[model samples]
Target: MNTGNSPLAAGRARLGALSLAITGVLFLLYPLVRPYADEKSMQGAEAMASPAWVAAHLFGAVGFIFLALGLLGLRIALRETAAEPLASRAVVVTWIGAGLTLLYFGAEDFSLNAIGQRAVNEQNLKLLVELTEAVRYNPAAITVFGAGLVLLAVGVILAAVAVWRSGLLPRWSGVPLALGFALFIPQFFGTPAMRIAHGLLITAGSLWLASSLWRAQRR
Candidate 1:
Protein backbone atom coordinates (compact mmCIF):
# COMPACT_ATOMS: atom_id res chain seq x y z
CA MET A 1 0.00 0.00 0.00
CA ASN A 2 2.97 2.31 0.53
CA THR A 3 4.17 4.38 -2.40
CA GLY A 4 7.58 2.77 -2.21
CA ASN A 5 5.99 -0.64 -2.55
CA SER A 6 3.72 0.33 -5.41
CA PRO A 7 3.87 -1.59 -8.73
CA LEU A 8 4.98 1.61 -10.43
CA ALA A 9 8.09 1.74 -8.27
CA ALA A 10 8.86 -1.87 -9.06
CA GLY A 11 8.46 -1.20 -12.74
CA ARG A 12 10.81 1.76 -12.51
CA ALA A 13 13.43 -0.38 -10.84
CA ARG A 14 13.22 -2.94 -13.60
CA LEU A 15 13.45 -0.24 -16.23
CA GLY A 16 16.48 1.32 -14.59
CA ALA A 17 18.25 -1.99 -14.38
CA LEU A 18 17.59 -2.80 -17.99
CA SER A 19 18.69 0.64 -19.16
CA LEU A 20 21.96 0.49 -17.28
CA ALA A 21 22.70 -2.99 -18.54
CA ILE A 22 22.08 -1.95 -22.12
CA THR A 23 24.15 1.20 -21.72
CA GLY A 24 27.07 -0.90 -20.55
CA VAL A 25 26.78 -3.22 -23.49
CA LEU A 26 26.67 -0.33 -25.90
CA PHE A 27 29.75 1.27 -24.40
CA LEU A 28 31.55 -2.02 -24.70
CA LEU A 29 30.76 -2.05 -28.38
CA TYR A 30 31.87 1.56 -28.93
CA PRO A 31 35.24 0.60 -30.31
CA LEU A 32 33.57 -1.32 -33.06
CA VAL A 33 31.47 1.65 -34.08
CA ARG A 34 34.24 4.18 -33.69
CA PRO A 35 36.26 5.48 -36.57
CA TYR A 36 39.41 3.60 -37.37
CA ALA A 37 42.77 5.27 -37.06
CA ASP A 38 43.68 8.07 -39.52
CA GLU A 39 40.11 9.30 -39.34
CA LYS A 40 41.18 12.77 -40.33
CA SER A 41 42.48 11.51 -43.62
CA MET A 42 40.56 10.91 -46.83
CA GLN A 43 40.53 7.26 -46.02
CA GLY A 44 38.93 7.98 -42.69
CA ALA A 45 36.18 10.07 -44.25
CA GLU A 46 35.48 7.25 -46.63
CA ALA A 47 35.27 4.85 -43.75
CA MET A 48 32.99 7.17 -41.81
CA ALA A 49 30.60 7.14 -44.72
CA SER A 50 30.31 3.41 -44.55
CA PRO A 51 27.12 1.84 -43.22
CA ALA A 52 28.89 0.43 -40.20
CA TRP A 53 30.18 3.80 -39.07
CA VAL A 54 26.80 5.49 -39.42
CA ALA A 55 25.12 2.66 -37.57
CA ALA A 56 27.68 2.99 -34.81
CA HIS A 57 26.84 6.66 -34.32
CA LEU A 58 23.16 5.84 -34.18
CA PHE A 59 23.80 3.14 -31.61
CA GLY A 60 25.99 5.43 -29.52
CA ALA A 61 23.25 8.06 -29.45
CA VAL A 62 20.73 5.53 -28.26
CA GLY A 63 23.15 4.30 -25.61
CA PHE A 64 23.54 7.81 -24.24
CA ILE A 65 19.79 8.12 -23.98
CA PHE A 66 19.59 4.90 -21.99
CA LEU A 67 22.42 6.06 -19.76
CA ALA A 68 20.57 9.30 -19.01
CA LEU A 69 17.38 7.47 -18.10
CA GLY A 70 19.23 4.91 -16.02
CA LEU A 71 21.00 7.58 -14.01
CA LEU A 72 17.73 9.43 -13.42
CA GLY A 73 16.17 6.25 -12.08
CA LEU A 74 19.21 5.66 -9.92
CA ARG A 75 18.85 9.12 -8.42
CA ILE A 76 15.18 8.49 -7.65
CA ALA A 77 15.90 5.14 -6.05
CA LEU A 78 18.67 6.57 -3.89
CA ARG A 79 16.48 9.46 -2.82
CA GLU A 80 13.74 7.05 -1.83
CA THR A 81 16.08 5.37 0.62
CA ALA A 82 17.10 7.16 3.78
CA ALA A 83 20.65 8.39 3.21
CA GLU A 84 23.25 10.39 5.01
CA PRO A 85 23.72 14.00 3.98
CA LEU A 86 26.83 13.09 2.02
CA ALA A 87 25.02 10.36 0.17
CA SER A 88 22.16 12.65 -0.73
CA ARG A 89 24.54 15.23 -2.15
CA ALA A 90 26.41 12.57 -4.05
CA VAL A 91 23.17 11.37 -5.60
CA VAL A 92 22.43 14.84 -6.86
CA VAL A 93 25.89 15.17 -8.36
CA THR A 94 25.66 11.78 -9.98
CA TRP A 95 22.41 12.60 -11.77
CA ILE A 96 23.58 16.04 -12.90
CA GLY A 97 26.88 14.79 -14.22
CA ALA A 98 25.24 11.82 -15.88
CA GLY A 99 22.65 14.00 -17.55
CA LEU A 100 25.18 16.46 -18.91
CA THR A 101 27.51 13.78 -20.21
CA LEU A 102 24.65 11.98 -21.92
CA LEU A 103 23.31 15.17 -23.46
CA TYR A 104 26.68 16.09 -24.92
CA PHE A 105 27.35 12.67 -26.32
CA GLY A 106 23.82 12.24 -27.66
CA ALA A 107 24.11 15.48 -29.63
CA GLU A 108 27.68 14.86 -30.80
CA ASP A 109 27.00 11.34 -31.92
CA PHE A 110 23.87 12.18 -33.88
CA SER A 111 24.69 15.60 -35.32
CA LEU A 112 28.36 15.08 -36.04
CA ASN A 113 27.74 11.79 -37.73
CA ALA A 114 25.02 13.32 -39.85
CA ILE A 115 27.37 16.09 -40.90
CA GLY A 116 30.09 13.63 -41.80
CA GLN A 117 27.67 11.55 -43.83
CA ARG A 118 26.40 14.54 -45.72
CA ALA A 119 29.86 15.89 -46.41
CA VAL A 120 30.87 12.60 -47.88
CA ASN A 121 27.75 12.43 -50.06
CA GLU A 122 28.34 15.92 -51.38
CA GLN A 123 32.00 15.18 -52.22
CA ASN A 124 33.20 17.88 -49.89
CA LEU A 125 36.46 16.21 -49.06
CA LYS A 126 37.95 19.39 -47.60
CA LEU A 127 34.99 19.97 -45.33
CA LEU A 128 34.88 16.34 -44.30
CA VAL A 129 38.57 16.34 -43.44
CA GLU A 130 38.26 19.54 -41.43
CA LEU A 131 35.25 18.26 -39.52
CA THR A 132 36.94 14.96 -38.78
CA GLU A 133 39.98 16.71 -37.40
CA ALA A 134 37.85 18.98 -35.28
CA VAL A 135 35.95 16.09 -33.85
CA ARG A 136 39.06 14.09 -33.10
CA TYR A 137 41.59 16.70 -32.02
CA ASN A 138 39.77 19.92 -31.33
CA PRO A 139 41.13 21.27 -28.09
CA ALA A 140 37.89 22.85 -26.94
CA ALA A 141 35.84 19.77 -27.66
CA ILE A 142 38.33 17.57 -25.88
CA THR A 143 38.40 19.78 -22.81
CA VAL A 144 34.64 20.04 -22.49
CA PHE A 145 34.01 16.36 -23.07
CA GLY A 146 36.84 15.35 -20.77
CA ALA A 147 35.54 17.57 -18.01
CA GLY A 148 32.11 16.03 -18.23
CA LEU A 149 33.54 12.52 -18.04
CA VAL A 150 35.65 13.42 -15.03
CA LEU A 151 32.69 14.95 -13.27
CA LEU A 152 30.57 11.90 -13.95
CA ALA A 153 33.30 9.56 -12.73
CA VAL A 154 33.94 11.56 -9.59
CA GLY A 155 30.25 11.73 -8.81
CA VAL A 156 29.90 7.97 -9.19
CA ILE A 157 32.84 7.35 -6.90
CA LEU A 158 31.49 9.75 -4.32
CA ALA A 159 28.05 8.19 -4.47
CA ALA A 160 29.55 4.72 -4.09
CA VAL A 161 31.49 5.79 -1.02
CA ALA A 162 28.40 7.33 0.51
CA VAL A 163 26.33 4.27 -0.19
CA TRP A 164 28.97 2.07 1.36
CA ARG A 165 29.17 4.09 4.53
CA SER A 166 25.45 4.79 4.83
CA GLY A 167 24.06 1.36 3.90
CA LEU A 168 21.69 3.00 1.47
CA LEU A 169 22.45 0.08 -0.83
CA PRO A 170 24.33 -3.16 -0.24
CA ARG A 171 27.85 -2.39 0.93
CA TRP A 172 29.27 -4.85 -1.54
CA SER A 173 27.93 -2.86 -4.47
CA GLY A 174 29.71 0.28 -3.39
CA VAL A 175 33.23 -1.09 -3.66
CA PRO A 176 32.89 -2.16 -7.26
CA LEU A 177 31.07 0.99 -8.18
CA ALA A 178 33.95 3.02 -6.83
CA LEU A 179 36.45 0.80 -8.54
CA GLY A 180 34.54 1.20 -11.79
CA PHE A 181 34.97 4.95 -11.62
CA ALA A 182 38.60 4.55 -10.70
CA LEU A 183 39.04 2.69 -13.94
CA PHE A 184 37.89 5.81 -15.70
CA ILE A 185 41.39 7.18 -15.27
CA PRO A 186 42.69 4.83 -17.93
CA GLN A 187 39.73 5.69 -20.10
CA PHE A 188 40.64 9.35 -19.79
CA PHE A 189 43.99 8.53 -21.26
CA GLY A 190 42.19 6.76 -24.11
CA THR A 191 43.00 3.23 -23.16
CA PRO A 192 40.54 0.98 -24.96
CA ALA A 193 40.76 -1.98 -22.66
CA MET A 194 40.20 0.15 -19.60
CA ARG A 195 37.12 1.64 -21.18
CA ILE A 196 35.64 -1.82 -21.65
CA ALA A 197 36.59 -2.81 -18.11
CA HIS A 198 34.99 0.35 -16.74
CA GLY A 199 31.81 -0.41 -18.63
CA LEU A 200 31.69 -3.94 -17.18
CA LEU A 201 32.22 -2.74 -13.64
CA ILE A 202 29.58 -0.02 -13.90
CA THR A 203 27.14 -2.50 -15.40
CA ALA A 204 27.64 -4.89 -12.52
CA GLY A 205 27.20 -2.11 -9.99
CA SER A 206 24.03 -0.82 -11.63
CA LEU A 207 22.50 -4.28 -11.72
CA TRP A 208 23.32 -4.72 -8.07
CA LEU A 209 21.67 -1.42 -7.19
CA ALA A 210 18.62 -2.30 -9.23
CA SER A 211 18.32 -5.62 -7.40
CA SER A 212 18.52 -3.86 -4.09
CA LEU A 213 15.80 -1.40 -5.09
CA TRP A 214 13.53 -4.21 -6.25
CA ARG A 215 14.01 -6.06 -2.96
CA ALA A 216 13.32 -2.92 -1.01
CA GLN A 217 10.05 -2.41 -2.84
CA ARG A 218 8.93 -5.91 -1.97
CA ARG A 219 9.69 -5.34 1.67
Candidate 2:
Protein backbone atom coordinates (compact mmCIF):
# COMPACT_ATOMS: atom_id res chain seq x y z
CA MET A 1 0.00 0.00 0.00
CA ASN A 2 3.00 2.28 -0.09
CA THR A 3 2.00 4.12 -3.29
CA GLY A 4 4.15 7.15 -2.43
CA ASN A 5 7.37 5.47 -3.58
CA SER A 6 6.16 4.30 -7.01
CA PRO A 7 7.83 6.25 -9.81
CA LEU A 8 4.65 6.78 -11.69
CA ALA A 9 2.83 7.95 -8.64
CA ALA A 10 5.82 9.86 -7.46
CA GLY A 11 6.21 11.54 -10.81
CA ARG A 12 2.59 12.49 -10.87
CA ALA A 13 2.72 13.58 -7.28
CA ARG A 14 5.91 15.49 -7.84
CA LEU A 15 4.42 17.24 -10.83
CA GLY A 16 1.32 18.02 -8.87
CA ALA A 17 3.35 19.32 -5.98
CA LEU A 18 5.85 21.24 -8.09
CA SER A 19 3.13 22.83 -10.16
CA LEU A 20 1.88 24.74 -7.14
CA ALA A 21 5.30 26.15 -6.38
CA ILE A 22 6.14 27.04 -9.97
CA THR A 23 2.82 28.75 -10.36
CA GLY A 24 3.25 30.67 -7.11
CA VAL A 25 6.53 32.14 -8.28
CA LEU A 26 5.03 33.02 -11.61
CA PHE A 27 2.14 34.79 -9.94
CA LEU A 28 4.34 36.73 -7.58
CA LEU A 29 6.63 37.98 -10.31
CA TYR A 30 4.18 38.36 -13.19
CA PRO A 31 3.44 42.02 -12.48
CA LEU A 32 7.12 42.79 -12.68
CA VAL A 33 7.47 41.32 -16.14
CA ARG A 34 4.09 42.08 -17.64
CA PRO A 35 3.77 45.06 -19.96
CA TYR A 36 2.64 48.42 -18.67
CA ALA A 37 0.67 50.96 -20.65
CA ASP A 38 -1.08 54.31 -20.49
CA GLU A 39 -4.24 53.88 -18.53
CA LYS A 40 -5.92 55.87 -21.27
CA SER A 41 -4.72 53.96 -24.31
CA MET A 42 -5.18 50.41 -23.17
CA GLN A 43 -4.17 50.13 -26.78
CA GLY A 44 -1.40 47.73 -25.66
CA ALA A 45 1.83 48.13 -23.76
CA GLU A 46 5.00 46.41 -22.54
CA ALA A 47 7.20 46.43 -19.45
CA MET A 48 10.41 47.98 -20.63
CA ALA A 49 12.01 51.43 -20.21
CA SER A 50 10.83 51.73 -16.64
CA PRO A 51 13.32 50.49 -14.08
CA ALA A 52 10.52 48.84 -12.12
CA TRP A 53 9.30 47.05 -15.22
CA VAL A 54 12.81 45.87 -15.97
CA ALA A 55 13.16 44.49 -12.49
CA ALA A 56 9.78 42.80 -12.73
CA HIS A 57 10.62 41.32 -16.09
CA LEU A 58 13.82 39.89 -14.71
CA PHE A 59 12.02 38.40 -11.73
CA GLY A 60 9.19 37.11 -13.88
CA ALA A 61 11.62 35.49 -16.27
CA VAL A 62 13.11 33.59 -13.36
CA GLY A 63 9.61 32.50 -12.33
CA PHE A 64 9.00 31.14 -15.80
CA ILE A 65 12.15 29.08 -15.48
CA PHE A 66 10.54 27.39 -12.51
CA LEU A 67 7.33 26.91 -14.43
CA ALA A 68 9.27 25.26 -17.22
CA LEU A 69 10.72 22.87 -14.70
CA GLY A 70 7.26 22.00 -13.42
CA LEU A 71 6.13 21.41 -16.95
CA LEU A 72 9.06 19.10 -17.61
CA GLY A 73 8.07 17.23 -14.50
CA LEU A 74 4.58 16.88 -15.89
CA ARG A 75 6.03 15.57 -19.11
CA ILE A 76 7.94 12.96 -17.12
CA ALA A 77 4.74 11.98 -15.38
CA LEU A 78 2.97 11.47 -18.68
CA ARG A 79 5.65 9.71 -20.71
CA GLU A 80 4.95 6.16 -22.05
CA THR A 81 3.86 4.73 -18.72
CA ALA A 82 0.35 4.28 -20.03
CA ALA A 83 -0.27 2.24 -23.19
CA GLU A 84 -1.16 5.43 -25.06
CA PRO A 85 0.99 7.49 -27.35
CA LEU A 86 -1.55 10.25 -27.95
CA ALA A 87 -1.62 11.25 -24.31
CA SER A 88 2.12 11.38 -24.00
CA ARG A 89 2.42 13.33 -27.21
CA ALA A 90 -0.11 15.83 -25.99
CA VAL A 91 1.84 16.37 -22.79
CA VAL A 92 5.05 16.83 -24.67
CA VAL A 93 3.46 19.25 -27.07
CA THR A 94 2.00 21.25 -24.22
CA TRP A 95 5.32 21.43 -22.41
CA ILE A 96 7.09 22.64 -25.52
CA GLY A 97 4.35 25.05 -26.43
CA ALA A 98 4.23 26.56 -22.98
CA GLY A 99 7.98 27.03 -22.94
CA LEU A 100 8.00 28.71 -26.31
CA THR A 101 5.06 30.88 -25.45
CA LEU A 102 6.60 31.91 -22.15
CA LEU A 103 9.82 32.95 -23.83
CA TYR A 104 8.02 34.79 -26.60
CA PHE A 105 5.71 36.49 -24.17
CA GLY A 106 8.63 37.68 -22.12
CA ALA A 107 10.26 39.16 -25.17
CA GLU A 108 7.04 40.81 -26.20
CA ASP A 109 6.66 42.22 -22.72
CA PHE A 110 9.93 44.13 -22.84
CA SER A 111 9.63 45.09 -26.49
CA LEU A 112 6.12 46.41 -26.25
CA ASN A 113 6.80 48.39 -23.13
CA ALA A 114 9.86 49.95 -24.68
CA ILE A 115 7.90 50.79 -27.79
CA GLY A 116 5.03 52.21 -25.81
CA GLN A 117 7.20 54.41 -23.68
CA ARG A 118 8.92 55.72 -26.76
CA ALA A 119 5.53 56.59 -28.19
CA VAL A 120 4.44 58.30 -24.98
CA ASN A 121 5.99 60.20 -22.12
CA GLU A 122 5.36 61.32 -18.52
CA GLN A 123 2.35 63.33 -19.65
CA ASN A 124 0.65 60.08 -20.59
CA LEU A 125 0.29 61.27 -24.15
CA LYS A 126 1.88 60.03 -27.31
CA LEU A 127 5.38 61.47 -27.44
CA LEU A 128 6.39 60.16 -30.79
CA VAL A 129 3.23 60.47 -32.78
CA GLU A 130 5.27 59.93 -35.93
CA LEU A 131 6.31 56.54 -34.65
CA THR A 132 2.74 55.43 -34.46
CA GLU A 133 2.47 56.47 -38.07
CA ALA A 134 5.62 54.52 -38.79
CA VAL A 135 4.28 51.49 -36.98
CA ARG A 136 1.20 51.67 -39.09
CA TYR A 137 3.26 51.80 -42.28
CA ASN A 138 5.74 49.17 -41.14
CA PRO A 139 4.60 45.61 -40.60
CA ALA A 140 7.35 44.40 -38.24
CA ALA A 141 5.54 45.16 -35.03
CA ILE A 142 2.35 43.62 -36.31
CA THR A 143 4.21 40.53 -37.42
CA VAL A 144 5.88 40.15 -34.05
CA PHE A 145 2.59 40.56 -32.26
CA GLY A 146 0.97 37.98 -34.49
CA ALA A 147 3.69 35.43 -33.84
CA GLY A 148 3.50 35.89 -30.08
CA LEU A 149 -0.27 35.62 -30.15
CA VAL A 150 -0.19 32.43 -32.15
CA LEU A 151 2.26 30.79 -29.79
CA LEU A 152 0.15 31.81 -26.82
CA ALA A 153 -2.95 30.36 -28.40
CA VAL A 154 -1.37 26.98 -29.11
CA GLY A 155 0.40 26.85 -25.76
CA VAL A 156 -2.72 27.58 -23.75
CA ILE A 157 -4.81 24.99 -25.60
CA LEU A 158 -2.25 22.24 -25.20
CA ALA A 159 -1.26 23.06 -21.62
CA ALA A 160 -4.84 23.40 -20.43
CA VAL A 161 -5.67 19.95 -21.66
CA ALA A 162 -2.50 18.45 -20.22
CA VAL A 163 -3.10 19.99 -16.81
CA TRP A 164 -6.67 18.83 -16.82
CA ARG A 165 -5.77 15.23 -17.63
CA SER A 166 -2.48 14.82 -15.79
CA GLY A 167 -4.16 14.66 -12.39
CA LEU A 168 -0.88 16.07 -11.15
CA LEU A 169 -2.47 19.38 -10.20
CA PRO A 170 -5.86 20.68 -9.30
CA ARG A 171 -8.42 20.74 -12.09
CA TRP A 172 -8.82 24.47 -11.42
CA SER A 173 -5.55 25.14 -13.18
CA GLY A 174 -7.42 24.36 -16.36
CA VAL A 175 -9.69 27.33 -15.71
CA PRO A 176 -6.87 29.86 -16.22
CA LEU A 177 -5.66 28.02 -19.29
CA ALA A 178 -9.12 28.14 -20.74
CA LEU A 179 -9.57 31.78 -19.79
CA GLY A 180 -6.20 32.72 -21.21
CA PHE A 181 -7.02 30.95 -24.47
CA ALA A 182 -10.33 32.67 -24.68
CA LEU A 183 -8.73 36.08 -24.09
CA PHE A 184 -6.54 35.84 -27.19
CA ILE A 185 -9.47 36.53 -29.46
CA PRO A 186 -9.94 40.00 -28.07
CA GLN A 187 -6.26 40.74 -28.58
CA PHE A 188 -6.80 40.36 -32.32
CA PHE A 189 -10.07 42.22 -32.48
CA GLY A 190 -8.15 45.49 -32.20
CA THR A 191 -10.22 46.99 -29.48
CA PRO A 192 -8.98 48.62 -26.28
CA ALA A 193 -11.87 47.23 -24.26
CA MET A 194 -11.09 43.76 -25.48
CA ARG A 195 -7.44 44.06 -24.56
CA ILE A 196 -8.34 45.10 -21.02
CA ALA A 197 -10.63 42.13 -20.65
CA HIS A 198 -8.03 39.86 -22.14
CA GLY A 199 -5.39 41.24 -19.83
CA LEU A 200 -7.57 40.55 -16.81
CA LEU A 201 -8.25 37.01 -17.90
CA ILE A 202 -4.61 36.33 -18.61
CA THR A 203 -3.60 37.79 -15.28
CA ALA A 204 -6.12 35.63 -13.47
CA GLY A 205 -4.88 32.50 -15.21
CA SER A 206 -1.24 33.29 -14.47
CA LEU A 207 -1.98 33.73 -10.80
CA TRP A 208 -4.01 30.53 -10.67
CA LEU A 209 -1.25 28.48 -12.25
CA ALA A 210 1.29 30.03 -9.88
CA SER A 211 -0.87 29.19 -6.94
CA SER A 212 -1.37 25.64 -8.11
CA LEU A 213 2.36 25.15 -8.54
CA TRP A 214 3.12 26.57 -5.11
CA ARG A 215 0.53 24.40 -3.42
CA ALA A 216 1.96 21.31 -5.08
CA GLN A 217 5.41 22.04 -3.69
CA ARG A 218 4.06 22.42 -0.19
CA ARG A 219 2.66 18.89 -0.27
Ten contiguous residues minimizing lDDT sum, candidate 1: 1-10
lDDT of 2 by residue, 97-146 (tens): 45554554565446545666764455343543444445433466455545
Which residue runs of candidate 1 sit more than 4 Å off their true CA positions?
Answer: 1-11, 79-87, 111-129, 136-140, 188-194
lDDT of 1 by residue, 1-219 (tens): 123535676667567657766766675566555666455556666666666665665665566566556655555555545544555566566666655565556545655666667776786778876765666556766666666667767766776665666444577765665566556546645655555566666667666765664565456
Best by TM-score: 1
Root-mean-square deviation of every model: 4.1, 6.0
Error of 1 at 214 (Å): 3.1
TM-score of 1: 0.70
Q: How many clashes (backbone atoms < 3 Å, residues ≥3 apart in a chain or on different chains) does model 2 have?
A: 14
Tell me the whole-model lDDT of each prediction, alpha carbons only: 0.61, 0.51
Candidate 2 lDDT score relative to the true structure:
0.51
Task: After the best TM-score superposition of candidate 1, give how far the Cα of residue 150 lies from its true spot, in angstroms.
Answer: 1.9
The TM-score values for the models, in the order shown, are 0.70, 0.54
